[model samples]
Target: MDDIRNIYCVGRNYRLHAQELGNEVPKSPMIFSKPTHALVETTGQEIVLPGNRGEVHYEAEFVIHISKPYKPGMKVEDVVDQFALGIDFTLRDVQSELKKKGHPWLLAKGFPNSAIITKFRAFPGVEACKEVDFSLIRNGQEVQRGNIQDMLFDLETIILFCSQHFGIGAGDIIYTGTPAGVGPVTDGDRLQLKWGEEILGECFIRLG
Candidate 1:
Protein backbone atom coordinates (compact mmCIF):
# COMPACT_ATOMS: atom_id res chain seq x y z
CA MET A 1 0.00 0.00 0.00
CA ASP A 2 1.19 3.51 -0.71
CA ASP A 3 1.89 5.04 2.67
CA ILE A 4 0.01 8.31 2.83
CA ARG A 5 2.45 11.20 3.14
CA ASN A 6 0.62 14.00 4.95
CA ILE A 7 -2.69 15.85 5.01
CA TYR A 8 -2.00 19.50 5.78
CA CYS A 9 -4.91 21.94 6.10
CA VAL A 10 -5.12 25.63 6.85
CA GLY A 11 -7.81 27.17 9.04
CA ARG A 12 -9.39 30.61 8.76
CA ASN A 13 -7.56 31.02 5.47
CA TYR A 14 -10.50 32.91 4.02
CA ARG A 15 -12.00 35.80 5.99
CA LEU A 16 -15.53 34.89 5.00
CA HIS A 17 -15.00 31.24 5.82
CA ALA A 18 -13.66 32.31 9.18
CA GLN A 19 -16.88 34.19 9.86
CA GLU A 20 -18.99 31.29 8.68
CA LEU A 21 -17.09 28.98 11.01
CA GLY A 22 -17.77 31.48 13.82
CA ASN A 23 -14.07 32.17 14.29
CA GLU A 24 -12.58 35.43 15.40
CA VAL A 25 -9.92 37.16 13.31
CA PRO A 26 -7.15 34.62 13.64
CA LYS A 27 -3.80 35.56 15.11
CA SER A 28 -2.11 32.88 12.98
CA PRO A 29 -3.12 30.20 10.55
CA MET A 30 -4.54 27.09 12.22
CA ILE A 31 -3.39 23.85 10.65
CA PHE A 32 -4.52 20.22 10.70
CA SER A 33 -4.29 16.95 8.82
CA LYS A 34 -6.50 14.41 7.03
CA PRO A 35 -5.59 11.04 5.57
CA THR A 36 -3.76 10.82 2.26
CA HIS A 37 -6.41 8.72 0.57
CA ALA A 38 -8.90 11.51 1.22
CA LEU A 39 -7.63 13.15 -1.97
CA VAL A 40 -9.87 13.39 -5.04
CA GLU A 41 -8.95 14.59 -8.48
CA THR A 42 -11.52 16.81 -10.19
CA THR A 43 -10.50 15.97 -13.75
CA GLY A 44 -13.59 14.17 -14.98
CA GLN A 45 -13.89 11.90 -11.98
CA GLU A 46 -16.40 10.92 -9.29
CA ILE A 47 -16.14 11.10 -5.48
CA VAL A 48 -16.96 7.98 -3.56
CA LEU A 49 -17.22 7.97 0.24
CA PRO A 50 -16.40 5.30 2.80
CA GLY A 51 -19.50 6.19 4.90
CA ASN A 52 -17.48 6.96 8.01
CA ARG A 53 -19.00 10.37 8.40
CA GLY A 54 -22.67 11.19 8.41
CA GLU A 55 -22.44 14.14 6.06
CA VAL A 56 -19.50 14.64 3.71
CA HIS A 57 -18.99 18.37 3.53
CA TYR A 58 -17.24 20.23 0.74
CA GLU A 59 -14.56 22.87 1.36
CA ALA A 60 -13.15 24.49 -1.79
CA GLU A 61 -9.50 24.88 -0.82
CA PHE A 62 -6.53 26.06 -2.82
CA VAL A 63 -4.06 23.18 -3.23
CA ILE A 64 -0.28 23.23 -3.62
CA HIS A 65 1.91 20.71 -5.41
CA ILE A 66 5.58 20.79 -4.44
CA SER A 67 7.94 20.57 -7.36
CA LYS A 68 11.11 19.75 -5.43
CA PRO A 69 12.54 18.91 -2.02
CA TYR A 70 13.40 21.65 0.45
CA LYS A 71 16.61 21.96 2.41
CA PRO A 72 16.83 22.99 6.05
CA GLY A 73 16.88 26.72 6.78
CA MET A 74 15.17 27.09 3.42
CA LYS A 75 13.48 30.42 3.12
CA VAL A 76 10.04 30.78 1.64
CA GLU A 77 11.64 32.13 -1.49
CA ASP A 78 13.80 29.06 -1.79
CA VAL A 79 10.82 26.75 -2.00
CA VAL A 80 8.59 29.43 -3.44
CA ASP A 81 9.88 28.24 -6.77
CA GLN A 82 7.67 25.18 -6.40
CA PHE A 83 4.03 25.85 -5.51
CA ALA A 84 0.88 24.23 -6.86
CA LEU A 85 -2.72 24.56 -5.71
CA GLY A 86 -5.86 22.39 -5.30
CA ILE A 87 -9.02 21.81 -3.12
CA ASP A 88 -9.56 20.33 0.36
CA PHE A 89 -13.02 18.87 1.06
CA THR A 90 -14.30 18.42 4.59
CA LEU A 91 -16.90 16.45 6.55
CA ARG A 92 -18.68 19.13 8.60
CA ASP A 93 -20.87 16.93 10.74
CA VAL A 94 -18.11 14.55 11.70
CA GLN A 95 -15.69 17.41 12.17
CA SER A 96 -18.13 19.11 14.51
CA GLU A 97 -18.65 15.95 16.52
CA LEU A 98 -14.93 15.44 16.86
CA LYS A 99 -14.48 19.01 18.01
CA LYS A 100 -17.02 18.45 20.75
CA LYS A 101 -14.93 15.58 22.05
CA GLY A 102 -11.62 17.41 21.64
CA HIS A 103 -10.56 14.78 19.18
CA PRO A 104 -8.56 14.68 16.00
CA TRP A 105 -10.60 15.23 12.82
CA LEU A 106 -8.87 12.36 11.05
CA LEU A 107 -11.96 10.40 10.13
CA ALA A 108 -13.85 13.53 9.24
CA LYS A 109 -11.13 14.83 6.97
CA GLY A 110 -9.65 11.59 5.69
CA PHE A 111 -12.24 9.66 3.76
CA PRO A 112 -12.24 8.46 0.19
CA ASN A 113 -12.73 11.41 -2.20
CA SER A 114 -12.83 13.87 0.69
CA ALA A 115 -10.15 15.96 -1.02
CA ILE A 116 -10.94 17.14 -4.57
CA ILE A 117 -8.19 18.60 -6.76
CA THR A 118 -7.16 19.56 -10.29
CA LYS A 119 -3.93 19.23 -12.23
CA PHE A 120 -1.00 21.44 -11.17
CA ARG A 121 0.19 23.70 -13.91
CA ALA A 122 2.79 26.34 -13.18
CA PHE A 123 1.24 29.72 -12.34
CA PRO A 124 3.72 32.28 -13.60
CA GLY A 125 4.03 36.08 -13.34
CA VAL A 126 1.56 35.98 -10.45
CA GLU A 127 4.18 36.96 -7.82
CA ALA A 128 3.45 33.78 -5.91
CA CYS A 129 0.10 35.49 -5.79
CA LYS A 130 -3.25 33.97 -6.71
CA GLU A 131 -6.48 35.37 -8.05
CA VAL A 132 -9.17 32.74 -7.86
CA ASP A 133 -12.95 32.53 -7.99
CA PHE A 134 -14.24 29.11 -6.94
CA SER A 135 -17.78 27.76 -6.63
CA LEU A 136 -19.41 24.34 -6.32
CA ILE A 137 -22.68 24.23 -8.22
CA ARG A 138 -25.15 21.66 -7.07
CA ASN A 139 -28.20 21.06 -9.23
CA GLY A 140 -27.09 24.13 -11.18
CA GLN A 141 -27.10 26.53 -8.22
CA GLU A 142 -23.88 28.13 -6.98
CA VAL A 143 -23.34 26.99 -3.38
CA GLN A 144 -19.78 28.09 -2.60
CA ARG A 145 -17.40 30.90 -3.51
CA GLY A 146 -13.71 31.13 -2.43
CA ASN A 147 -11.02 33.45 -3.64
CA ILE A 148 -7.34 32.59 -3.19
CA GLN A 149 -6.42 36.14 -2.28
CA ASP A 150 -8.70 35.83 0.73
CA MET A 151 -6.56 33.08 2.20
CA LEU A 152 -4.90 34.15 5.47
CA PHE A 153 -1.75 32.23 4.60
CA ASP A 154 -0.35 32.65 1.14
CA LEU A 155 1.65 30.11 -0.86
CA GLU A 156 4.98 31.19 0.59
CA THR A 157 3.87 30.84 4.20
CA ILE A 158 2.09 27.55 3.60
CA ILE A 159 5.09 26.10 1.79
CA LEU A 160 7.45 27.37 4.44
CA PHE A 161 5.49 25.88 7.29
CA CYS A 162 5.00 22.62 5.42
CA SER A 163 8.73 22.13 4.91
CA GLN A 164 9.37 22.50 8.63
CA HIS A 165 7.82 19.10 9.20
CA PHE A 166 7.92 17.37 5.85
CA GLY A 167 10.57 17.51 3.15
CA ILE A 168 8.59 18.75 0.17
CA GLY A 169 9.74 16.84 -2.86
CA ALA A 170 8.55 16.29 -6.39
CA GLY A 171 4.93 15.15 -6.73
CA ASP A 172 4.12 16.20 -3.16
CA ILE A 173 0.68 17.82 -3.28
CA ILE A 174 -0.83 20.07 -0.66
CA TYR A 175 -4.48 21.06 -0.35
CA THR A 176 -4.09 24.63 1.00
CA GLY A 177 -7.49 24.59 2.75
CA THR A 178 -11.03 25.76 2.07
CA PRO A 179 -13.22 28.84 2.12
CA ALA A 180 -16.54 29.00 3.92
CA GLY A 181 -20.13 28.23 2.83
CA VAL A 182 -19.47 24.49 3.17
CA GLY A 183 -22.35 22.09 2.73
CA PRO A 184 -23.28 18.45 2.22
CA VAL A 185 -22.84 16.40 -0.96
CA THR A 186 -25.12 13.45 -1.63
CA ASP A 187 -25.08 10.58 -4.06
CA GLY A 188 -26.08 11.42 -7.66
CA ASP A 189 -25.12 15.02 -7.09
CA ARG A 190 -22.71 16.65 -9.50
CA LEU A 191 -20.11 19.18 -8.30
CA GLN A 192 -18.25 21.80 -10.28
CA LEU A 193 -15.04 23.39 -8.91
CA LYS A 194 -14.24 26.40 -11.04
CA TRP A 195 -11.48 28.94 -10.88
CA GLY A 196 -12.57 32.13 -12.59
CA GLU A 197 -13.38 31.56 -16.27
CA GLU A 198 -11.63 28.19 -16.34
CA ILE A 199 -13.39 25.13 -15.01
CA LEU A 200 -10.85 23.51 -12.66
CA GLY A 201 -12.79 20.25 -12.90
CA GLU A 202 -15.94 18.41 -11.89
CA CYS A 203 -16.97 15.34 -9.92
CA PHE A 204 -20.12 13.36 -9.17
CA ILE A 205 -21.21 11.69 -5.94
CA ARG A 206 -21.71 7.94 -5.96
CA LEU A 207 -23.05 6.09 -2.94
CA GLY A 208 -22.04 2.52 -2.27
Candidate 2:
Protein backbone atom coordinates (compact mmCIF):
# COMPACT_ATOMS: atom_id res chain seq x y z
CA MET A 1 0.00 0.00 0.00
CA ASP A 2 1.14 3.50 -0.80
CA ASP A 3 1.23 5.54 2.39
CA ILE A 4 0.26 9.19 2.30
CA ARG A 5 2.28 11.20 4.79
CA ASN A 6 -0.08 14.14 5.14
CA ILE A 7 -3.43 15.36 3.84
CA TYR A 8 -4.05 19.11 4.09
CA CYS A 9 -7.06 21.00 2.88
CA VAL A 10 -7.61 24.72 2.35
CA GLY A 11 -11.03 26.11 3.17
CA ARG A 12 -12.64 28.96 1.23
CA ASN A 13 -9.73 29.50 -1.10
CA TYR A 14 -12.19 30.63 -3.71
CA ARG A 15 -14.08 33.85 -3.05
CA LEU A 16 -17.19 32.75 -4.92
CA HIS A 17 -17.46 29.52 -2.96
CA ALA A 18 -17.08 31.36 0.32
CA GLN A 19 -19.79 33.83 -0.63
CA GLU A 20 -22.10 31.05 -1.80
CA LEU A 21 -21.75 29.38 1.59
CA GLY A 22 -22.61 32.74 3.28
CA ASN A 23 -19.15 33.06 4.76
CA GLU A 24 -17.16 36.25 4.88
CA VAL A 25 -14.12 36.45 2.69
CA PRO A 26 -11.19 35.27 4.77
CA LYS A 27 -8.16 37.49 5.33
CA SER A 28 -5.91 34.43 4.98
CA PRO A 29 -6.30 30.81 4.00
CA MET A 30 -8.44 28.64 6.32
CA ILE A 31 -6.81 25.27 6.72
CA PHE A 32 -8.10 21.90 7.87
CA SER A 33 -6.76 18.37 7.64
CA LYS A 34 -7.98 14.87 6.94
CA PRO A 35 -6.35 11.66 7.97
CA THR A 36 -4.15 10.20 5.26
CA HIS A 37 -6.27 7.08 5.13
CA ALA A 38 -9.31 9.08 4.14
CA LEU A 39 -8.18 9.09 0.51
CA VAL A 40 -9.97 6.83 -1.98
CA GLU A 41 -8.73 6.44 -5.50
CA THR A 42 -11.45 6.71 -8.14
CA THR A 43 -10.03 4.21 -10.59
CA GLY A 44 -12.47 1.35 -10.08
CA GLN A 45 -14.70 1.89 -7.06
CA GLU A 46 -17.83 3.75 -6.04
CA ILE A 47 -17.82 6.24 -3.18
CA VAL A 48 -19.49 4.57 -0.19
CA LEU A 49 -21.47 6.86 2.10
CA PRO A 50 -21.82 7.15 5.85
CA GLY A 51 -25.20 5.88 6.96
CA ASN A 52 -25.84 8.23 9.89
CA ARG A 53 -24.91 11.55 8.29
CA GLY A 54 -27.88 13.56 7.18
CA GLU A 55 -26.31 14.87 3.99
CA VAL A 56 -23.06 14.50 2.16
CA HIS A 57 -22.15 17.37 -0.12
CA TYR A 58 -19.69 17.19 -2.94
CA GLU A 59 -16.91 19.77 -3.22
CA ALA A 60 -14.86 19.66 -6.40
CA GLU A 61 -11.28 20.73 -5.88
CA PHE A 62 -7.87 20.63 -7.45
CA VAL A 63 -5.40 18.38 -5.68
CA ILE A 64 -1.63 18.63 -5.46
CA HIS A 65 0.84 15.89 -4.69
CA ILE A 66 4.17 16.68 -3.11
CA SER A 67 6.99 14.90 -4.91
CA LYS A 68 9.87 15.51 -2.55
CA PRO A 69 10.54 16.47 1.04
CA TYR A 70 9.98 20.20 1.37
CA LYS A 71 12.11 22.45 3.52
CA PRO A 72 11.26 25.93 4.73
CA GLY A 73 12.94 27.70 1.85
CA MET A 74 11.68 25.52 -0.99
CA LYS A 75 9.44 27.19 -3.52
CA VAL A 76 5.91 25.82 -3.84
CA GLU A 77 6.32 25.58 -7.59
CA ASP A 78 9.14 23.10 -7.13
CA VAL A 79 7.44 20.93 -4.57
CA VAL A 80 4.51 19.91 -6.73
CA ASP A 81 4.84 16.61 -8.57
CA GLN A 82 1.46 16.20 -10.17
CA PHE A 83 -2.07 17.59 -10.36
CA ALA A 84 -5.55 16.06 -10.41
CA LEU A 85 -9.19 16.78 -9.79
CA GLY A 86 -10.48 15.61 -6.41
CA ILE A 87 -13.64 15.68 -4.35
CA ASP A 88 -13.87 16.75 -0.72
CA PHE A 89 -17.02 15.16 0.64
CA THR A 90 -18.59 17.05 3.51
CA LEU A 91 -21.32 16.10 5.95
CA ARG A 92 -23.13 19.42 5.69
CA ASP A 93 -25.64 18.80 8.46
CA VAL A 94 -22.95 17.75 10.87
CA GLN A 95 -20.77 20.68 9.91
CA SER A 96 -23.61 23.13 10.48
CA GLU A 97 -24.20 21.89 14.00
CA LEU A 98 -20.50 21.91 14.79
CA LYS A 99 -20.16 25.49 13.58
CA LYS A 100 -23.12 26.64 15.64
CA LYS A 101 -21.52 25.20 18.76
CA GLY A 102 -18.02 26.46 17.91
CA HIS A 103 -16.60 22.98 17.62
CA PRO A 104 -14.09 21.38 15.31
CA TRP A 105 -15.40 19.69 12.16
CA LEU A 106 -13.73 16.35 12.57
CA LEU A 107 -16.64 14.03 11.91
CA ALA A 108 -18.15 16.40 9.41
CA LYS A 109 -15.08 16.71 7.23
CA GLY A 110 -12.62 13.92 7.92
CA PHE A 111 -14.60 10.73 7.69
CA PRO A 112 -13.06 7.78 5.88
CA ASN A 113 -13.54 7.83 2.07
CA SER A 114 -14.28 11.56 2.22
CA ALA A 115 -11.43 12.32 -0.12
CA ILE A 116 -11.68 10.98 -3.69
CA ILE A 117 -9.02 11.52 -6.34
CA THR A 118 -8.27 10.96 -9.97
CA LYS A 119 -5.08 9.78 -11.55
CA PHE A 120 -2.58 12.65 -11.57
CA ARG A 121 -0.74 14.26 -14.45
CA ALA A 122 2.76 15.64 -14.33
CA PHE A 123 2.88 19.18 -13.02
CA PRO A 124 4.80 21.56 -15.28
CA GLY A 125 5.21 24.26 -12.61
CA VAL A 126 3.29 27.47 -11.84
CA GLU A 127 4.17 29.83 -14.63
CA ALA A 128 3.07 27.34 -17.23
CA CYS A 129 -0.16 26.51 -15.44
CA LYS A 130 -2.02 29.79 -15.87
CA GLU A 131 -4.67 28.59 -18.28
CA VAL A 132 -5.62 25.28 -16.66
CA ASP A 133 -9.36 24.76 -16.36
CA PHE A 134 -11.45 22.19 -14.49
CA SER A 135 -15.12 21.34 -14.06
CA LEU A 136 -17.40 18.94 -12.23
CA ILE A 137 -20.39 17.32 -13.90
CA ARG A 138 -23.07 15.71 -11.77
CA ASN A 139 -25.88 13.70 -13.27
CA GLY A 140 -24.86 14.87 -16.76
CA GLN A 141 -25.02 18.58 -15.89
CA GLU A 142 -22.19 20.92 -15.15
CA VAL A 143 -22.33 21.93 -11.49
CA GLN A 144 -18.99 23.61 -10.86
CA ARG A 145 -16.56 25.34 -13.21
CA GLY A 146 -13.21 26.83 -12.21
CA ASN A 147 -10.01 28.15 -13.67
CA ILE A 148 -6.69 28.23 -11.95
CA GLN A 149 -6.64 31.96 -12.60
CA ASP A 150 -9.66 32.49 -10.34
CA MET A 151 -8.06 31.31 -7.11
CA LEU A 152 -7.89 34.05 -4.46
CA PHE A 153 -4.81 32.60 -2.86
CA ASP A 154 -2.57 31.19 -5.56
CA LEU A 155 -0.84 27.84 -5.35
CA GLU A 156 2.43 29.15 -3.99
CA THR A 157 0.82 31.05 -1.15
CA ILE A 158 -1.28 28.09 -0.05
CA ILE A 159 1.70 25.75 0.00
CA LEU A 160 3.81 28.35 1.82
CA PHE A 161 1.12 28.99 4.39
CA CYS A 162 0.68 25.31 5.17
CA SER A 163 4.39 24.69 5.31
CA GLN A 164 4.60 27.25 8.09
CA HIS A 165 2.60 25.07 10.46
CA PHE A 166 3.60 21.58 9.26
CA GLY A 167 6.45 21.06 6.90
CA ILE A 168 5.18 19.69 3.57
CA GLY A 169 7.04 16.49 2.78
CA ALA A 170 7.06 13.77 0.20
CA GLY A 171 3.70 12.00 -0.40
CA ASP A 172 1.77 14.94 1.05
CA ILE A 173 -1.46 15.85 -0.71
CA ILE A 174 -3.15 19.22 -0.57
CA TYR A 175 -6.71 19.85 -1.64
CA THR A 176 -6.88 23.46 -2.84
CA GLY A 177 -10.55 23.90 -1.95
CA THR A 178 -13.66 23.98 -4.09
CA PRO A 179 -15.37 26.47 -6.35
CA ALA A 180 -19.01 27.51 -6.14
CA GLY A 181 -22.01 25.28 -6.95
CA VAL A 182 -21.65 22.64 -4.28
CA GLY A 183 -24.68 20.48 -3.54
CA PRO A 184 -25.79 17.24 -1.95
CA VAL A 185 -25.61 13.89 -3.67
CA THR A 186 -28.00 10.97 -3.55
CA ASP A 187 -27.56 7.32 -4.26
CA GLY A 188 -27.09 6.57 -8.00
CA ASP A 189 -25.87 10.08 -8.78
CA ARG A 190 -22.89 9.98 -11.09
CA LEU A 191 -19.97 12.41 -10.89
CA GLN A 192 -17.49 13.21 -13.59
CA LEU A 193 -14.45 15.43 -13.21
CA LYS A 194 -12.66 17.02 -16.14
CA TRP A 195 -9.55 19.09 -16.60
CA GLY A 196 -9.41 20.93 -19.86
CA GLU A 197 -9.92 18.21 -22.45
CA GLU A 198 -8.84 15.42 -20.16
CA ILE A 199 -11.30 13.33 -18.22
CA LEU A 200 -9.84 13.14 -14.75
CA GLY A 201 -12.10 10.54 -13.21
CA GLU A 202 -15.67 9.44 -12.55
CA CYS A 203 -17.60 7.67 -9.80
CA PHE A 204 -21.08 6.67 -8.74
CA ILE A 205 -22.64 7.55 -5.40
CA ARG A 206 -23.89 4.67 -3.26
CA LEU A 207 -25.75 5.38 -0.03
CA GLY A 208 -27.29 2.81 2.25
Candidate 3:
Protein backbone atom coordinates (compact mmCIF):
# COMPACT_ATOMS: atom_id res chain seq x y z
CA MET A 1 0.00 0.00 0.00
CA ASP A 2 1.16 3.54 -0.74
CA ASP A 3 1.08 6.44 1.66
CA ILE A 4 -1.79 8.82 0.97
CA ARG A 5 -1.17 12.48 1.69
CA ASN A 6 -4.71 13.76 2.26
CA ILE A 7 -8.33 12.95 1.50
CA TYR A 8 -11.18 15.41 0.96
CA CYS A 9 -14.77 14.51 0.12
CA VAL A 10 -17.28 17.25 -0.61
CA GLY A 11 -20.68 16.89 1.00
CA ARG A 12 -24.21 17.76 -0.26
CA ASN A 13 -23.02 19.00 -3.61
CA TYR A 14 -26.08 17.54 -5.22
CA ARG A 15 -29.46 19.00 -4.42
CA LEU A 16 -31.13 15.61 -4.81
CA HIS A 17 -28.62 13.89 -2.55
CA ALA A 18 -29.11 16.61 0.06
CA GLN A 19 -32.87 16.26 -0.19
CA GLU A 20 -32.68 12.48 -0.02
CA LEU A 21 -30.45 12.66 3.06
CA GLY A 22 -32.98 15.12 4.52
CA ASN A 23 -30.64 18.10 4.39
CA GLU A 24 -31.49 21.33 2.66
CA VAL A 25 -29.30 22.08 -0.33
CA PRO A 26 -26.53 24.31 0.97
CA LYS A 27 -26.08 27.83 -0.28
CA SER A 28 -22.40 26.80 -0.26
CA PRO A 29 -20.55 23.55 -0.64
CA MET A 30 -20.26 21.24 2.35
CA ILE A 31 -17.16 19.14 2.96
CA PHE A 32 -16.16 15.88 4.61
CA SER A 33 -13.13 13.60 4.49
CA LYS A 34 -11.78 10.07 4.68
CA PRO A 35 -8.34 8.84 5.61
CA THR A 36 -6.14 8.79 2.59
CA HIS A 37 -5.36 5.17 3.38
CA ALA A 38 -9.02 4.42 2.87
CA LEU A 39 -8.71 4.78 -0.88
CA VAL A 40 -9.40 1.57 -2.87
CA GLU A 41 -7.37 1.37 -6.06
CA THR A 42 -6.97 -2.13 -7.43
CA THR A 43 -8.40 -3.29 -10.70
CA GLY A 44 -10.91 -6.02 -9.85
CA GLN A 45 -10.47 -5.18 -6.21
CA GLU A 46 -12.94 -6.26 -3.49
CA ILE A 47 -14.58 -4.53 -0.48
CA VAL A 48 -15.97 -5.98 2.69
CA LEU A 49 -18.86 -4.58 4.70
CA PRO A 50 -19.03 -5.02 8.43
CA GLY A 51 -21.51 -7.83 9.01
CA ASN A 52 -23.10 -5.94 11.91
CA ARG A 53 -24.33 -3.21 9.56
CA GLY A 54 -24.45 -4.89 6.22
CA GLU A 55 -25.06 -2.05 3.83
CA VAL A 56 -22.05 -0.99 1.76
CA HIS A 57 -22.95 1.66 -0.81
CA TYR A 58 -21.01 3.09 -3.73
CA GLU A 59 -20.67 6.89 -4.24
CA ALA A 60 -19.13 7.87 -7.55
CA GLU A 61 -17.11 11.11 -7.20
CA PHE A 62 -14.94 13.24 -9.40
CA VAL A 63 -11.35 12.61 -8.23
CA ILE A 64 -8.89 15.43 -8.51
CA HIS A 65 -5.16 14.69 -8.71
CA ILE A 66 -3.23 17.75 -7.68
CA SER A 67 0.08 18.73 -9.22
CA LYS A 68 0.77 21.96 -7.36
CA PRO A 69 0.57 23.49 -3.95
CA TYR A 70 -2.99 24.23 -2.78
CA LYS A 71 -3.26 27.24 -0.52
CA PRO A 72 -5.76 29.86 0.57
CA GLY A 73 -7.15 32.01 -2.26
CA MET A 74 -6.30 29.26 -4.74
CA LYS A 75 -8.78 29.04 -7.55
CA VAL A 76 -10.10 26.01 -9.37
CA GLU A 77 -8.59 27.60 -12.44
CA ASP A 78 -5.22 27.13 -10.79
CA VAL A 79 -5.75 23.52 -9.81
CA VAL A 80 -8.28 22.61 -12.45
CA ASP A 81 -5.52 21.14 -14.59
CA GLN A 82 -5.33 18.10 -12.33
CA PHE A 83 -8.54 16.14 -12.25
CA ALA A 84 -10.02 12.69 -12.95
CA LEU A 85 -12.99 10.46 -12.26
CA GLY A 86 -13.55 7.92 -9.47
CA ILE A 87 -15.92 6.44 -6.88
CA ASP A 88 -16.39 7.43 -3.23
CA PHE A 89 -17.68 4.14 -1.81
CA THR A 90 -19.72 4.58 1.36
CA LEU A 91 -21.56 2.43 3.88
CA ARG A 92 -25.01 3.99 3.81
CA ASP A 93 -26.27 2.18 6.87
CA VAL A 94 -23.01 2.83 8.70
CA GLN A 95 -23.13 6.51 7.84
CA SER A 96 -26.73 6.77 8.95
CA GLU A 97 -25.87 5.05 12.21
CA LEU A 98 -22.96 7.39 12.78
CA LYS A 99 -25.05 10.41 12.01
CA LYS A 100 -27.69 9.44 14.53
CA LYS A 101 -25.00 9.21 17.20
CA GLY A 102 -23.38 12.49 16.06
CA HIS A 103 -20.10 10.85 15.21
CA PRO A 104 -17.43 11.80 12.70
CA TRP A 105 -17.25 9.50 9.66
CA LEU A 106 -13.86 7.98 10.42
CA LEU A 107 -15.21 4.47 10.94
CA ALA A 108 -17.75 4.94 8.22
CA LYS A 109 -15.09 6.02 5.74
CA GLY A 110 -11.76 4.60 6.95
CA PHE A 111 -12.26 0.92 6.20
CA PRO A 112 -9.80 -0.78 3.90
CA ASN A 113 -10.60 -0.49 0.19
CA SER A 114 -13.28 2.06 0.90
CA ALA A 115 -12.50 4.41 -2.01
CA ILE A 116 -12.18 3.17 -5.60
CA ILE A 117 -10.83 5.51 -8.25
CA THR A 118 -10.58 4.98 -12.00
CA LYS A 119 -7.70 6.06 -14.16
CA PHE A 120 -7.92 9.84 -14.74
CA ARG A 121 -7.51 11.71 -17.98
CA ALA A 122 -7.49 15.30 -19.24
CA PHE A 123 -9.37 14.68 -22.48
CA PRO A 124 -12.58 16.15 -21.10
CA GLY A 125 -12.55 19.90 -20.48
CA VAL A 126 -12.68 20.80 -16.79
CA GLU A 127 -14.98 23.85 -17.03
CA ALA A 128 -18.10 21.82 -17.80
CA CYS A 129 -16.74 18.57 -16.50
CA LYS A 130 -20.34 17.64 -15.82
CA GLU A 131 -20.70 16.45 -19.39
CA VAL A 132 -20.14 12.93 -18.19
CA ASP A 133 -23.16 10.73 -17.58
CA PHE A 134 -22.60 8.56 -14.48
CA SER A 135 -24.35 5.25 -13.91
CA LEU A 136 -23.66 2.21 -11.77
CA ILE A 137 -24.91 -1.18 -12.93
CA ARG A 138 -25.10 -3.95 -10.38
CA ASN A 139 -24.95 -7.49 -11.72
CA GLY A 140 -26.59 -7.01 -15.16
CA GLN A 141 -29.19 -4.36 -14.43
CA GLU A 142 -29.04 -0.60 -13.82
CA VAL A 143 -29.04 0.50 -10.20
CA GLN A 144 -27.91 4.18 -9.89
CA ARG A 145 -27.92 7.06 -12.35
CA GLY A 146 -26.65 10.71 -12.21
CA ASN A 147 -25.27 13.54 -14.29
CA ILE A 148 -22.56 16.11 -13.45
CA GLN A 149 -24.85 19.11 -13.68
CA ASP A 150 -26.89 17.79 -10.79
CA MET A 151 -24.10 18.76 -8.39
CA LEU A 152 -25.14 21.65 -6.14
CA PHE A 153 -21.49 22.59 -5.52
CA ASP A 154 -19.59 23.43 -8.65
CA LEU A 155 -15.95 22.42 -9.09
CA GLU A 156 -14.48 25.90 -8.91
CA THR A 157 -16.35 26.54 -5.69
CA ILE A 158 -15.16 23.25 -4.28
CA ILE A 159 -11.52 24.11 -4.92
CA LEU A 160 -11.90 27.56 -3.41
CA PHE A 161 -13.91 26.57 -0.33
CA CYS A 162 -11.57 23.71 0.57
CA SER A 163 -8.40 25.68 0.09
CA GLN A 164 -9.77 28.48 2.22
CA HIS A 165 -10.00 26.41 5.37
CA PHE A 166 -7.46 23.75 4.51
CA GLY A 167 -3.70 23.80 4.29
CA ILE A 168 -3.89 21.91 1.01
CA GLY A 169 -0.88 21.33 -1.18
CA ALA A 170 0.43 19.44 -4.16
CA GLY A 171 -0.39 15.77 -4.78
CA ASP A 172 -3.57 15.97 -2.78
CA ILE A 173 -6.83 14.43 -3.97
CA ILE A 174 -10.38 15.66 -3.56
CA TYR A 175 -13.32 13.30 -4.05
CA THR A 176 -16.03 15.73 -5.08
CA GLY A 177 -19.56 14.78 -4.04
CA THR A 178 -21.63 11.95 -5.48
CA PRO A 179 -25.08 12.27 -6.96
CA ALA A 180 -28.30 10.72 -5.72
CA GLY A 181 -29.41 7.08 -6.31
CA VAL A 182 -26.62 5.59 -4.17
CA GLY A 183 -27.09 2.01 -2.98
CA PRO A 184 -25.31 -0.98 -1.55
CA VAL A 185 -23.01 -3.47 -3.27
CA THR A 186 -22.62 -7.01 -2.04
CA ASP A 187 -19.86 -9.48 -2.75
CA GLY A 188 -19.78 -10.90 -6.29
CA ASP A 189 -21.15 -7.70 -7.75
CA ARG A 190 -19.74 -5.84 -10.75
CA LEU A 191 -19.73 -1.98 -10.95
CA GLN A 192 -19.29 0.10 -14.05
CA LEU A 193 -18.86 3.88 -14.71
CA LYS A 194 -19.27 5.40 -18.15
CA TRP A 195 -19.05 8.67 -20.06
CA GLY A 196 -21.08 8.43 -23.22
CA GLU A 197 -20.15 5.38 -25.32
CA GLU A 198 -16.68 5.28 -23.83
CA ILE A 199 -16.31 2.85 -20.94
CA LEU A 200 -14.38 4.84 -18.31
CA GLY A 201 -13.57 1.76 -16.20
CA GLU A 202 -15.15 -0.97 -14.07
CA CYS A 203 -14.60 -2.57 -10.64
CA PHE A 204 -15.96 -5.65 -8.90
CA ILE A 205 -16.61 -5.86 -5.16
CA ARG A 206 -15.64 -9.05 -3.44
CA LEU A 207 -14.11 -10.10 -0.09
CA GLY A 208 -11.64 -7.73 1.46
- Estimate the overall C-alpha local distance difference test score of candidate 2: 0.86
How many residue pairs clash per model? 7, 0, 2
- In angstroms, what RMSD does candidate 1 have relative to the true structure? 3.1
lDDT of 1: 0.66
TM-score of 3: 0.86
Give all candidates' CA lDDT scores. Answer: 0.66, 0.86, 0.70
lDDT tens string, model 3, 46-119? 55545455677777766776656766666665764555557777777778888989999778777766777766
Candidate 3 global lDDT: 0.70
Local error of candidate 1 at residue 88 (angstroms): 2.6
Ranking by TM-score: 2, 3, 1
lDDT of 2 at 62: 88
Candidate topping TM-score:
2
Write candidate 2's Cα lDDT for 24-106 as tens digits: 89899898999876888887467788857798999999888988876667786679989888999999999999999999988
Better of 2 and 3 by lDDT: 2
**Distance from true location, Cα of 110 in model 1, Å:** 0.7
- Candidate 3: residue 56 Cα off by (Å): 0.9
